[model samples]
Target: MDIDVFATAHRLEWQRLDALIRRRRRLTGPEVDELVELYQRAATHLSTVRSSGQDPALTARLSGLVARGRSAVTGAHASAWGDVSGFFVRTFPAVLYRMRWWWIGSALLSLALGAGIAVWIMADPQVQAAIGPPEEIRAYVEHDFANYYVEHPGASFAAQVWTNNAWVSALALVLGVFGCLPTVYVLAQNAANLGVAGGLMFAHGKGDIFLGLIIPHGLLELTAVFVAAGVGIKLGWTLIAPGPRPRLQALAEEARAAMAVVLGLVVVLFVSGLIEGFVTGWVHITWLRIAIGVAAEALFLAYVFVLGRKAVHEGETGDIAHRPETAPVAG
Candidate 1:
């Protein structure tokens, strides 16, 4: 393979990479460019040597230089706190803003379904009987419904709710790959349960108590769930209709973007869990609790439409910046 000839030809490039690695902190901009160029050349040289049965020592030296050069070019990562702040400020909201309509539709449909079920349960005597006897229904409405929240220690209950809600949101996102059918099933089950509870309460003449306790945390909690389901369903639909991109590529892009929602919803659900645990049962005032829930929901909406819009305008797609993206091409 004339190893010596190749070594003599590329020694200068290898040396440059070594020099750049040694003085990475002091390199001028041009020198930094030169370092990257040399790093690329050194990598090529190593590949050629490996394939051509070159001397082991020469191959090892080039390999070390290329490794060091790669590190110098990429630099270190930002702090953990910086990553967390960036996700909330830019990535999370930007995704929420971009995917707003999908979630909004989900919210409307789920709410309507819930309300319809409630109405059916309230008006149909057969359904009420199937649910249970009138006395049991009244007892549940008067006691068991609200008592469920206070039966456990607040902290423990909050933890349980946080974990359960997080799991459900995560399921919607992960199962979305198979098409949105699974996610829809999960949402339907939840809506049905909510409807039965609301209807039972209303039938027993405890409508105010029902809304007062449920509205506080359920507002934000359910919104987060809706968002999760919406994103999941959208991701699934991407497979069915990938637009201009290939199906696999479209799925990858949507999955990457939707994952941000999963993480963001965890925090949202945690806040809701706190409200459900401490505020719903602990706070005896109906109006004040509902007001707190409304305020939290408002803040979430503002954060998405305002900060999210700004980030989207600035070219953030909720995908991590360093990750490889599909390159744009002219048609």
Candidate 2:
């Protein structure tokens, strides 16, 4: 019965229902109605899973979720600290894993566009002149770009850059609702800007300097951005094609996840900002700086592919997974 497809189609409803059942002392009238509807849908899903698949795990998980819903849904609630930890360890990574394809595609497409733009600028004098006058371009390539990192105190700069990047990431996610056009526009502008800078640097024989300064922080920073763009695109697409679910419900579900997704992105960008401010400019050894950047990028990839994959395998989807009740199940 294509269990994965079924789960993906309905997981959001389950998550919403689980949340309504577990938390919130008060539910609005609509939310209460949603809870009841979700409960019924989950029961149908459980029945489907049991009848069509030999997946004991799916059955047990759904059974637990249904049981809780049946019981006006209770909990032996995890501590606030544990909940926070779980959000990072489980929920956040699951979202990353789930959205991996979208972001990866975004990253590849943006990179290709940036590279193409850089090549065009380098190959054509008209393009180069259109970017800027020679003197201004040379100044940017030789001095301004490098000086940007060191112009401000590291701590303050890091904070400022973090806030800015976080806002950009959040904006990318939020703007997804209007349509992918806005999100695509944002990504295109960023790629074009980067391409212009890179083309100018390479043309002026400062390519090494550019990479050295940018890679350490740029790797992780751009990744965070790509993640946002991807999620945003998906959110926008949700409005257009909600698959089996109703359109508004699909949008609401995605929007809720998008909001939570921003919190994790803030932390990701803060790390990138620290590296940009402290390591990119201050670290004297070029190899060491580049190595640090590589390490950060590697670490982030591992975090998503490893922890994120694990979380998804266990049905985590950046929301409270519909878990089984605390009581022992009868054989």
Candidate 3:
């Protein structure tokens, strides 16, 4: 097929379609009918160009023109509420379920590392000495640790925790494009901190206090972090080995998926922050607080497994509606 001849033959029709799409709002009933017919014709033209293996540039421009035409004819500007509803019901859960193993592994590894570090700290006298004098350690275990939460007003404290956790999750996600190194470092640091805190509390015979406070919020809070980190690592791996797809294409898809996880985790972290600020410190009953955390965690897991699995089976990829995304090139 002669590229010049093909483009010249269809150029007028394409230009007419473009003009009608631009002025679609003011089109009369008959003109609207014309627009729909032109849109369908342009779509067929695009399919022909794609199948012919003509210039990639020609295919891309026709693709865009057809997309715009379709939008204008079909009223593609959907309501915002509909988009939000679709995200939770399909996008969020599908992404969560699709990547479940990645996050679950992260959660197990981090928790194991944290618990191991705590045990090591407790058993090693030298490690205890290295941390601080016994008296300072005891003071932290009994007073300063718990006091940290109550020092600020609940509302302010919740905001502070939410912002901090959100930032951490964002970093893990954004930096993950480079490779998994940054995310791994972030997760390791977090796990180590948890271990140190728990180990110190147990060493001073305040394990009950530590568990009571941490369990109420830490369950959900830490899970969100692990999820973020896991997704980030997965994004980095996509760059390293994109499998059968082109590397850039693979990275773009994974990056989009990771972003959805990032947005969803913000709400999850906020809930955990609320529990930390209000329930962890304020609630007197230990078992009740832990139960609340457990319940929150349970709901999250259910959302992923139930909604996510169903969405995945229904072909959700946690991405926007599929269309040709190739950028237009000058003809």
State which candidate has the highest TM-score. 3
Weakest ten-residue segment in model 3 by summed lDDT: 322-331
Kindly indicate the candidate among 1 and 2 with the higher TM-score. 1
- Candidates in order have lDDT scores of 0.87, 0.85, 0.88
Q: What does the lDDT read for residue 199 in candidate 2? A: 85
Ranking by TM-score: 3, 1, 2
TM agreement with the true structure for every prediction: 0.80, 0.76, 0.93
**What tens digits encode model 2's per-residue C-alpha lDDT throughout 1-331?**
7888988898888888889987545888887777778888898988998887556677888898887877663445678899889888988888989989989999999999999998888888899998788899878987899999999999999999998888888777778778788988888888998898888888778889989898989999999999999999999999988999878767777776776678889889989999998999999899999999999999999999999999899877775355442223333
Q: Please give me the total number of clashing residue pairs in predicted model 2.
A: 0
2 against 3, candidate with superior lDDT: 3
lDDT by residue (tens digit), candidate 1, 241-302: 99998888788888889989988998999999999989998998889999999999999999
What order do candidates take by lDDT, descending? 3, 1, 2
Between candidates 1 and 3, the TM-score winner: 3
TM-score quality measure for candidate 1: 0.80
